[model samples]
Target: MIPSRSDWTKALEIRHGKSLNEKFSKSTVAICGLGGLGSNIAISLARAGIGKLILIDFDIVDITNLHRQQYKANQVGEQKTTALSNNLREIAPYISLEIKNTKIDEDNLEELLLGADIVCEAVDVAETKAMIANEVLTHMPDKYLVAASGMAGIGSPNEIITRKITKKLYISGDGVSDVKNSIGLVSPRVMICAAHQALTVLRIIAEEFDL
Candidate 1:
């Protein structure tokens, strides 16, 4: 059976204190991609007891994604947001999950970020990433967007650093590698970038740092 509310309260009190739990449990986060970095970051946030998650991805899992994505080999043909939402629910049954099986574009960008406390951009394409950033900056000025770039191959994971672009936009990762690199990706570097993105989400949720 699932743990009771009191049980969760006791656990939080002993581990993170009431204020932190309250802050995290009430925040809603939207992850704009369910690729290598996004898959891991969404799961981490769900497990951390974020109240709600909005997962948006317009792609299906492919065999190539197995190297770094959190999904299993059997999930190759599944929709990315659907697969990720199922996995996150299995890990944290108490958290609410919303899956949007469509790409974030100019049309729906503002609507998608309307109520999100924080938005994470883990999409790999440069044009799409820039679009999301521009949309958030132009329309949703109050929300925070944690974006990731340069998580390809075995580059220096230590190079991943969070930089603030404005009062509401923050980016993390190497900021150098391009998708054209032939080296391919492994789990360690991807996980490091995902962790950085997750931490940025947590910081936004906790109100410890803005942007």
Candidate 2:
């Protein structure tokens, strides 16, 4: 059944007030990946009632992703964008989303990410994160990015933190872990970092905390 407007956002409206809800409902977020950090951040943003979302990922779901990402076993082999969309739609039936099943690179980053108020850098590799961060942080005046690092393993959950790298760039995680053979991403620590990224995005939207 389609949820009524009141039923859909009753709690959010009560907690955040109408103006904040309106602000969130009018902002757009572009999530550049659908891995553990990106997927969970996207889920939190949808739950927060962001106005629009741009989802981009080139990989297909794999069994290995089940431990860290938001994907399920049944979704294996499906494109990440498609699988994530299916899940987001279930929680927020009317959330606006744009899915791109293509890998992001310097060639098309600016064009593909246009109109986003905030961009969440959820990709795994250090090089890609630095590349995107350099571009978004240096050039975009109105755009902001939340990136993650060192979220692997069941480390101290308290260690997963968000710190402002610049006026427009925020990095989340313990800032030490890497997915080497002996160490790897775990669901709890990864999700904790995802929450930091998601909350940072929301705070950026809220415009309450000075970046």
Model 1, 47-152: lDDT tens per residue?
A: 7778899888999999988888889888889999888878887777778887788878999988877679899998878899999988887878788889987877
TM-scores, in order shown?
A: 0.93, 0.95
What lDDT is obtained when candidate 2 is compared to the true structure? 0.88
- Output the number of the TM-score-best candidate: 2
Q: Which sections of candidate 2 miss by over 4 Å?
A: none
lDDT, candidates in the order shown: 0.84, 0.88
Which ranges of candidate 1 are over 4 A from the true structure?
Answer: none
lDDT (Cα, tens digit) per residue for candidate 2, span 59-154: 999999998899989999999999999999998887899988898888888987999999999998778988998888777777988888888777
How far residue 76's Cα lies from its native spot in candidate 1, in Å, is: 2.2
Query: In model 1, what lDDT does residue 184 have?
Result: 70
State candidate 1's TM-score.
0.93
